[model samples]
Target: MDFIQQKDLSCFNTLGLKSWAKNYISLCNETDLKGVLGLLKSGAPYFILGGGSNVVLSEQIDQIVVHNQLKGINLVQESASEWLVEAAAGEIWHDFVVYCIQQGWYGLENLALIPGTVGAAPVQNIGAYGVELKDRLDSVLAYDPLTQTERVFNNGQCCFAYRDSLFKHEEGKGLIITAVRFRLPKQWTPVLSYPDLQQYESLQPGLTAQAILEAVCDIRRRKLPDPKVTGNAGSFFKNPVIPAQQYWPLKQQFPDLVAYEQPNDCYKLAAGWMIDQCGWKGRQLGNAGVHARQALVIINTGKACAADITAIAKAIANDVMNKFGVLLEPEPVFVGAGY
Candidate 1:
């Protein structure tokens, strides 16, 4: 483990926001974790960070940043029709998905190009192109900081909601994920359920895992801004889910409302459409602005502070709520001072 004081966290986060942490340590294994935890016990507040894709550091973090760098991959189990692959907490998510597809494994191809780590996947229940991580997750290994014990949680235990999981909830706080296991199909048909995905399929009749991955990548490339070039999280807010009865009345007021009804009698409304309708797309406020192509994403044009970005996001949410009567929830975890 390499420990440093007054560490610059600009390179660690995808947003490229300049922030400082009181102390930072990168843990490569379980043994390294023990030593790091010792520092935490010695009266240091700490935060566990993975790929740093889904977070926005609002201010200088006075706490210790424990960068989860544990890495490894192994086949835990296999059968004629399926296999279970286990990955450490720090493994890059998109790269792992591509690896599985290369091995002829199915299920994760639709989720290709998502930025983050294996441990963070379960926290957000990351999804794309009509497929969610919960569908492939076997279990997750996490260490409870309070209990000081390792626990394994199965699919049902995850309590997955749209773009959320137990880890994002109150009961699962202070648990640092160590690894995750996924059950993947040996033979399967690709899912082209989303409207864009279906249209892409029409262009190419038969598709495999690699083809689906390429399509997803292409779609994302055209829609979302690349974090490397533009400082932005994939989507700033989640698609709001509301009761079916509430959705229809809102739809009546706005006939162009985009929504999908879930099996549980709820409607998931398109956040991007709402933001775009409110005339926020491509709109700029100093260094902070909504991505020209994707209204759901808020970007930092070099000099924007975390507060500026948060202010812009809040304004978008307020405008959407005023127009559509639907409240928008931020997708990224806000650390330090919040909006």
Candidate 2:
């Protein structure tokens, strides 16, 4: 296994924050994965990085960073009702979604254009267009360094709940995800539950799975800034899911509050709407700023440092919390010191 020492990772992460790792390794296959784990210095801090899309590198890291680059896609199972496709952990998520659509597998179309890798998808329980990764995930193959054993977790075992999974828990830590299997239903139908998608259906008429995929890609492109053009990790905050008791009174006070009803009478308030209402949209704090068009995103404007980005985010969160009395949780994992 080849390892680079004191490697700079400014460009590796979508946020484009400057940081360095004490040691780094990029694995291309299962063999490489197992081999490197055994070589890692015991008791030393280590981090498993996917596409680096959902992480914030706040300072220089002393840990060993393992970059997952394993790649493959196979049709593992088939039945009259569904098809099971397994993709390697390192496969680009958006590309995999497109591949599934081309192969007539339809469920992942709603998750198109989501940045990051297949492995990171289940960890974050990634969601968009009214569809979540948990909806189609069959199982995940992960290697736990604790026992030095490989394990499989079914969808239920994953314990998915709104951008969260077992992979984010203490027990699941040190487990390197190897591959993810998705169960795409053959008797598929377009998920048009989201208002924007519903609007597309009314205007376009007769939307196919591919059409939905395209529409989602287009919608995301218009809504999100391209990371290549502007450094960002997509939505900076999770939509706050508040209890109905509080939501009802808050709704009366802020009539234009954008919120959606969840199961069990909870309400998911739009984080972007609240930030925008706090007068943060298109505003900049030093080199970091809230995206002008989408208040949910924080952007690195040219010379922004990790501190600059975090300061902007803290200000936004503070303002929103002060105004609405709802604490806004950030989406990206903050790495390094003083985070």
Candidate 3:
């Protein structure tokens, strides 16, 4: 592995935060794990970066940064009821969704246009519109660098939750996802449970998977700013899930609360709505600003650093908490303590 010294990574992260790495390497091949393991064994600290759509980078990282650029996609099998599709870790998530749709496989349309790589999806159990990755996942192929061996974990093994999976835990943290296999249903139905999709389908009357995919893309494009044009990490915070006991009183207090009742008697409160209610929509602190249309997004207006992003995020979170008593948690991973 050829490690570049002092690599500039402003363009590497979706937030466009100015950052520098003491050592950096782009892993384009799975076989390069041998070299990566050697470097790790040499007592050097390291960080694994995927599509860079879900992270906040610090100004300086005094460690090795391994960028995942691995890529491939294959149809493993075609059953009477479903299709088994597999994609490499570094494959663009939106591209893979389009490929599955092109093959006539359905079930992932609701998650269309989500940024990041296939590998990073399972880490956060990426979801949008009305569906989640766990709903279509067959299994995940991961490499254990310490053991120098690979293992395949089924959907259940993933321990998927709202915007989370086993991959975020300690045991699965070091496991490098190589590829992801999805079981997309052939006899598909539209997931129109989300209010946006529900209204869309009501307007369209008869909807197909392709149409749903297009609608999802349109909805996302309108809500999320392109990382290239205006740097942003999509949704900045996760929707807070509160117990039913607590939700009722809050609901009574704020009748216009936007929330979805969970299957487990909890309520997933919309973080964006709460932030907007707190008078934070389109607000700015330093170089960071809340996206005017989508209060969930914190954007880099111009060369914003992680500090600028954090400052705005902290202010919004604090305001939301003070008003609603719900603590907001950031969805993106912070790469350094400085942020």
Best by lDDT: 2
Give TM per candidate: 0.96, 0.97, 0.96
Candidate 2 displacement at residue 35 in angstroms: 1.9
Top-TM-score candidate index: 2
Q: Which lDDT tens digits does candidate 2 get at residues 44-123? A: 67899999999988567877888899999999999999999999999999999999989888899989999999999999
Model 3 deviation from native, Cα RMSD in Å: 1.6
- Once fitted onto the true fold, the runs of candidate 3 whose alpha carbons sit more than 4 angstroms away are 201-206
Give the CA lDDT, 0 to 100, for residue 170 in model 3.
86
Candidate 3 global CA lDDT score: 0.87
Q: CA shift at 84, candidate 1, in angstroms?
A: 0.5
lDDT tens digits by residue: candidate 3, 43-112: 5667788988989988998868988778999999988888899999999999989988888888888888
In model 2, how large is the Cα lDDT of residue 60?
76
lDDT of 3 at 145: 65
lDDT of each: 0.87, 0.89, 0.87
RMSD (Cα, Å) of model 2: 1.4
Which 10-residue window in model 2 sums to the lowest lDDT? 199-208
- lDDT (Cα) of model 1: 0.87
The number of clashing residue pairs in model 2 is: 0
Positional deviation of residue 25's Cα in model 3 after best superposition, in angstroms: 1.2
